[model samples]
Target: MEPLALLWDGILAATDPAIFACTILGAVIGLLIGALPGLGPTAGVAIMLPVAAGFGGVAAIACLGGVYYGSMFGGAITSILLGIPGDAPSVMTVIDGYPMAQKGEAGRALGTSVFASFVGGFLGIAGLVALSVPVSRYALAFGPTEMTAMMCFALSLLSVLGGRNAFKGFTALALGLWLGMVGLDPISGLPRYTGGSMNLFDGLDFSIIAVGLFGLTAIFTSLEVNVDKPVAKYTFASLLPRVSDAVQTRWQLLQGSVVGFFVGVLPGVGASAATMISYALAKRLSPTPEKYGTGIVEGVAAPEAANNSASYGSMIPLFTLGIPGSATTAVMMGGLIMVGLQPGPLLFTENPEFVWSVFGSFAIGNLALVFLTLLLTPLLAAALFVPTAYLYPIVIAVIVYGVFAIDASTFNVTLTILAGGAGIILARLDYPAVPLILGLVLGPLLERNIRRTLIQSQGDLLVFVERPIALGLFIATVFVLLIPLFLKLTGRKKIAADEAEV
Candidate 1:
């Protein structure tokens, strides 16, 4: 069957009233969860996974995918109104969005966000529909050596692109790798890092770690900063921007969507990185660059669009390779596995309806998110008035519930608290949690592939470099690592020369 026909059939199936209703319910739940501080898409999905598991594959995926996109849209709500980012990707939105709120243009800022989100999200889904089959076929040819090289390349690129400090990113990555080494050895049956603890046999739960790192840590950080201050409120009659506003932002939205989609396709380069890079690039190329952080409509549009596009883009790798591109994608991946559907090349061909249903549902969910956001912004804004003391505790309760709900294990809850504490300390020391999460997600894959390659090659290490695809990936990894160092050296020399001249 042709891919186009398969996609059309999937869309028709997804648009069936039963599936559409499930998608709407999932989006509504996700939106509310994402609009609240400390509750990101990852946590939202984790909390809902068990419920999704009870349903069939199509319904399960529709609900999970809807939650994913809905959170992408709803995250901007708190970022704009409360200056508290609802998700890591929404952090950039707070820069321009909060400023607009402060200037009494909250409604317009939100309007721009919704429109940009729709554009980016719709484009991203289109890209996914157009690209997933090709990408999956390409991925199918990759053996253990090629897969290992690809993982190395992804980790290298992510470490370089992470933030100002490469060392910190590596530190986080290494910590995650070490944590991943726990439990039984992949090749040998011996346990290396379990330290004789029976509870460690299953390894640390990724969902627990995620809840602790993003959810609990965020709560602690909020409390430590200033939970006493009341959030300011602003009112506007409409949340819809003028047609001219959309026209003015067309270029920024386009560039951001494209950039976001590509980044999202890469494992470890998720929505946060895409949104931040897009916003920075948009500002750099804007005619009025100086007005960026001052609440310009384009400012909100660029990041919102980039983030939403990236959210959909990340799903490509997840569905194609079983490699999640971000924390939220990791949750989705886990949800799929829990529901007895393994994600990868076989998934696309064997479960074409499920794949297409997820893709089509993203398109529908984004539209629902737009309407829901328009209707709920006024109510969401009122949530800002809820005291942080009250809000924080509720958030904490939710995080606890979310953690336990995943596996219903007390050990998981304990692990979550420990991971949360570790996350808080890591954040204070400028270490990123994303790399750690990425490492945890990719660690098992990396180990399994390495052992498989060694076994296939009869312990010959040369097999990794012998293949063209693996060799190319290795070269790319080297370049990704070296370019940053070269750029830093050049920048330092220029700075030194300018200082000497002055």
Candidate 2:
């Protein structure tokens, strides 16, 4: 069957009333979950996986896919209104978005976010449609060596390119790698760090750890900060962007979408990375780079668009290669597996309906997100008025409930709390949590693939360097490690020259 024909059939299946309804419902749930401080698309999808499992395959995929995009749209609400980023990706939005809000343009900022999100998400889905089949075929050639190399490249980019401090990011990566090794070794079947506890045998639950780090820690931090600061009231009159503003951001939107799509296609480089990268790129290319942090519409549009596009771009690897490109996509991949639908090349041939439904649902979900945001923004903003004292307990309960619901294990809940506490400490010390999460998520794959490659080559370590793809990744990793040093040396020289001038 031709790819176009398959896609057309998938579209028809996705538009079926049952699937459409489920998609709408999923979008609503995802938006609400994403608007909350600790819950992102990953936790939202993970919490809903069992429910999706009870449904059939098509409905399940549609629902989970909706949640993915819905969360992207909803994340901006908190960033704009409360100056609290609901997810890391939305942190970029806070740069211009909060300023717009402070200037009594909260509704306008939100409107721009919704529209840019729709455009970026739609374009990203289009890229997925055009690329998934070819990408799947390309991914079919990836062996253990290639997989390990790809994982290395992803970890390198995530750790080095993430935040201001490279050492802190590496520390987070090491901690995550250590945590990832706690379970039984996949190749040797020997326990490494179980510490004589049967509960540790399965290792830490990713969902529990994510919730603790993102959700619970966020709540705890919120308690430390005052939440009573006044925000500009938003009215319907403030809900639309100026035509001139839209025209001005046309270039930013285009550039941001492209940057976002490419970055998001890489495993573990999700919307957050894409947003930051896009923001940097936009500023570099802009004539008004200095105006970026001052609440310019272009700044808001660039990051918001990039993050949303990246959210869609994340689906590429998840659908085509069975590799999750981001944490949110990882959760969606779990949903697919739960429904007896494995992601990879065979998914296109055997489960065309599911594949198409998911892609098509993205198109629909993007539109639904716009409407849902318009309807829910006021209500969500009003939520800020509720006292922190009352809100923190509820947030804690929800995180605990959501974590336990994943595996129905109390130990998982304990892990969740501990991870949250650790995450809070890491956040305070200026450590990057994304790399830690990425390391934890990718550790099993990295370990398994390295061992498999070594075994395949009869314990030959040189095989990785001999392979072109692996060699390229190794070089890229080295480059990533060295770039910061080069930049620091150059920066120091410039500083010394300025001091000499003084």
Candidate 3:
């Protein structure tokens, strides 16, 4: 069937009143979950999986889709307003977003985020609708060798380029990798570093680490640092991005959307990797790269677009090939199964209406999410007005609640607290935490794939070079790692030559 005709069918199917209600309610819940710490889009969707199941397949999918994209917008709330990320995807948003907030442009940051996210979301859905089959088939070409190299390339993009201190960034990445390895070995089924505790059999929950690293760390920092800048009232003009702002960020939005959607199509990568990679890509492409962290609208636009696009891109594989591109989509796959809607090529042939309804829902969900985010901007911005002395306790409480909600485990909460202290120390030392987050997020994929590749090749290093795609990805990873160093060295030499001439 033609893509547009299929999409139109979906639009017709989604006009049912129940689906609309599900989308709206799910968006509301998703926004709330996303604006809170610890419970990211994945956890939010996971927690609501059973409840959404009761709504039936179409309604459940619409609801889950709403939440997925809604949380993408909501993540920017705390990231921009509070210097804390609501979820992992929004971590990049905090780099420039909170600074914009501090500069009394919280509204603009929020607006830019929503707008960019909408653009990304729309593009992602469009791609999914048009190219789902081709993309899924193309992805099938990636074997274990290709996956390992691709994962390495993805991890290298951020860990090498995003931080000022390469050594520190690597250290943080190492720490995250260690954290990812602390539980039982996935292949061996033996405890690696559980320390005789049953709580760690399932590994450290990423949500706990996420909440502790950003939410609790922010609270701890606020408690210790006494900055005297009084909160300023922001007018509507200062809150919204100007037309010029959009014009400036248009390229960034496009770049981020493309990068994110493509990367998100790969299984297990998620929005975290998409956002980090897009941010680095944006910086590399930017004329004013140094201004990224200090606050720039482009910086805010890029990752927001990337992560949203990635979310939509993730659904493509889930629908077409019964593969999940991320943890969030993995949960969504379960929902599909619960509703008796098995994913695969047969789904399009057997349940065309269901397929189209999902695509249509993504379109509607993105539009609705934009409005919800804009409407809630004022209220989210109001959070910035509260004094940190009074506000941080609430944040801490929320962090604890959010962490505890995952698995209902105390060990996870304890890990959160410990991670907070470690985050504070890392921040004080200027070691980047974002790279660590990426490492943790990508670790399983990296490890599992490499192990699988090794097993397939019987420990032959030549396997990496034998395949064309794997070799390309390996070369790309090396290039990504070396380019930054090359640039730094050449830059230093240029400066030295100029000084000597003077």
Best by lDDT: 1
lDDT of each: 0.81, 0.78, 0.77
Candidate 2: regions farther than 4 A off: 1-8, 15-22, 33-64, 78-88, 91-106, 237-248, 266-273, 276-299, 330-350, 495-502
Worst lDDT window (10 residues) for model 2?
Answer: 220-229
lDDT of 2: 0.78
lDDT of 1 by residue, 438-462 (tens): 7887888899999999998999999
Residues 1-502, candidate 3: write the lDDT tens digits: 6788878778778878999889888887788657765457865675566567678978999998888888888888878777778888999999999898888787788888888988999899888887875754576677778867866775676567546777786788788788889888998899978899988888876656665675566556545433233433456656555789899999999999999999888654578889999999999988889999988899999999998999988887677655455557755766687688766556776887887897887788788887777777666546445576686565466556655654577887798789888988998999977667657756776788789989988999899899998899899888877877898999999999999999
Which candidate leads the pack in TM-score?
1
Each model's TM-score, in the order given?
0.89, 0.85, 0.65
Please give the lDDT score at residue 315 for candidate 1.
Answer: 88
- Of candidate 1, the 10-residue stretch with the lowest lDDT total is 223-232
> How many clashing residue pairs are found in candidate 2?
2
Clashes per candidate, residues 3 or more apart or on different chains:
0, 2, 3
Cα distance off (Å), candidate 2, residue 99: 5.2
Give the TM-score (vs. native) of candidate 1: 0.89
Candidate ranking (TM-score, best to worst): 1, 2, 3
